[model samples]
Each structure stands twice: as structure tokens, then as C-alpha cells.
Target: MSRQQLAKLDQLSTGQTLKFNYRQNGVPREGFLVRLKDTWVAYENRCRHIAISLDSDNGEFFTQDGKYLFCQTHGAVYEPDTGLCVHGPCKGANLFSIPLEIGESGVWIDME
Candidate 1:
């Protein structure tokens, strides 16, 4: 596995997201890091129902209520902390989770 910094600790407040990219085993991939409450979570940007991106890089990942991660293209709703698709076509599936490392300096994603 490898570690790569995504953002500084203060760069994101609660309920905010930051988009990032990484290469795993020589394959390029897109991911996003979100700060929820005081915890940070991440997942691959790809939707479970389809290969399309969750937000198309528009950077809007939450529903109007800000209660869950939302896929604008397909109305998929995911639990922010677990990456579980709790609604929509992808129900019962989950966004590909990316492990994270948080520190005083920044946030990092562990890629394999």
C-alpha cells in the first residue's frame, strides 16, 4: 500500500468534501475525501450501479439535507461513514471505500 496526502487538517470543515486522484498498482483512479462531523471518510468516485462518476466532478456530493452522500446522475444515496448505498438503483451495494489516515498535518488515502 501507499500513502498520499489529500488535504490539510484545516482545509476541510465538517460536511465538506475534497476531490483527489491516485494511481493504484499503476492504474489511475479518482476518489474523494469528506469530513463528517469530526471524522473523515473516503471512497472511489465511481457509482455502484454504474461506472459513471457520482458527481461528474461538479463537487456536489451531498443531498439538499446534507444527510447522505448523493449521486446526482442516478439519485443514489450513501451513508457517509460506511459508503453504503442506502437508496436508489445501487441499493444494497456500496461505494468502493478508500482507507484514510488523518493527522495534524493532513489527510491521506491508502492505495494498494
Candidate 2:
């Protein structure tokens, strides 16, 4: 797998999300890095309901309790573990996942 150096894990805080580009299926795709439970997870940022960005003003993408990722645009809630929308408009919709792996070097996006 080809890995790309995107951003430092320390640069992100719990409940924060950042967008970046990575190669998938031999094509560049946009994805998001979300900090949760002291771990970072990467997923496609597009909301399945309307195919829009999940983050709203100031990149605020989490719920008030910071338990789940919430889409302010359409009120869709997603599970941080699998990027699956558990409630709201797209009940069965799930965020496309990007390959991610953490190691001694740091978090990395697998572009294989």
C-alpha cells in the first residue's frame, strides 16, 4: 500500500475533522480525518443523503456530546466506528471509508 503524509495526528483534537485527498481505485478521492476517543479515523466526507460535505461552519461536525458525527446540513448522524449513518435522513446511508492505518510513524492514509 502506498501511504501519503497528510497531517500530524496531534494537529487534530477530539471531535474535529479535516479533509484531504488520497488515491483510491487509481483515482484521487477526497476524504476526512476525524478524531475520536484519542484515535483518528478516515472516511469519505460526502454525505450519502445529498452527497454533500459533512462539516458545516468552522468544521463543526460532531454532536454536542461529541459522541457521533452530525451533519448540520441535513441532520444525519453517523457512527464513528464504521461511518454508518445510524439516524436521520439517510438511515441506511453510510460514509464511504478510506483505508487507514496507524503505526509508530503516525496515522497514515493507505492509497493502495
lDDT of 1: 0.89
Q: In candidate 1, list every pair of residues with a backbone clash.
A: none
Q: In candidate 1, where is summed lDDT lowest over 10 consecutive residues?
A: 103-112
Per-residue lDDT of model 2, residues 42-109, tens digit only:
88777888977787535677788888887889899999978889999998777887767777676787
lDDT assessment of candidate 2: 0.79
Candidate topping lDDT: 1
Q: Which portions of model 1 show Cα errors greater than 4 Å? A: none
Instruction: Quote each prediction's TM-score.
Output: 0.93, 0.82
Clashes of each: 0, 0
Residue-level lDDT of model 1, residues 1-112, one tens digit each, is 7788999888888999988998777799999999989689988899999899999779999989999998989799999999999999989998998888888888887766
lDDT of all predictions, in order shown? 0.89, 0.79
